[model samples]
Target: MEKWLVVLGIWAMCAACAVLFIRGATAGSDRRASVREGARAASRGSAGDTRAALND
Candidate 1:
């Protein structure tokens, strides 16, 4: 009985983790993409500036 309880508890934990993982993966994806795009744009702009400065 104790072993079974332990097994059930572990299973429930795993299920909860899976649910959270799915929710997290699906949630805020659009926001993440926007943020990623912004970061890439900023980096490109800065990189160009730095390269031009270095050449001069």
Candidate 2:
């Protein structure tokens, strides 16, 4: 019973870490895209940029 409890705790901790890591990664990706969008907006001469921004 003690061994099972220890295993369960470890599994729970790992699951929590995985969830946090995924959320952090997605947030970073969103921030990067947002910055790119702003840059695209600033470059008013590029039609491709507009298309890419819309696709994203």
lDDT of 2 by residue, 13-53 (tens): 99999999999999999999999989988786588778989
Candidate number of the best lDDT: 1
lDDT of 1 by residue, 1-56 (tens): 99999999999999999999989888879789999999999999999999999999
TM-score of 1: 0.53
Which parts of model 1 are misplaced by more than 4 Å?
A: 33-56
| Clashes within 3 Å, all models in order | 0, 0
After superposition on all C-alphas, the RMSD of every candidate to the true structure, in Å, is 5.4, 8.7
For each candidate in the order shown, give its overall lDDT on alpha carbons: 0.96, 0.93
TM-score, every prediction: 0.53, 0.74
TM-score of candidate 2 against the unseen true structure: 0.74
Clashing pairs in 1: none
lDDT of 1: 0.96
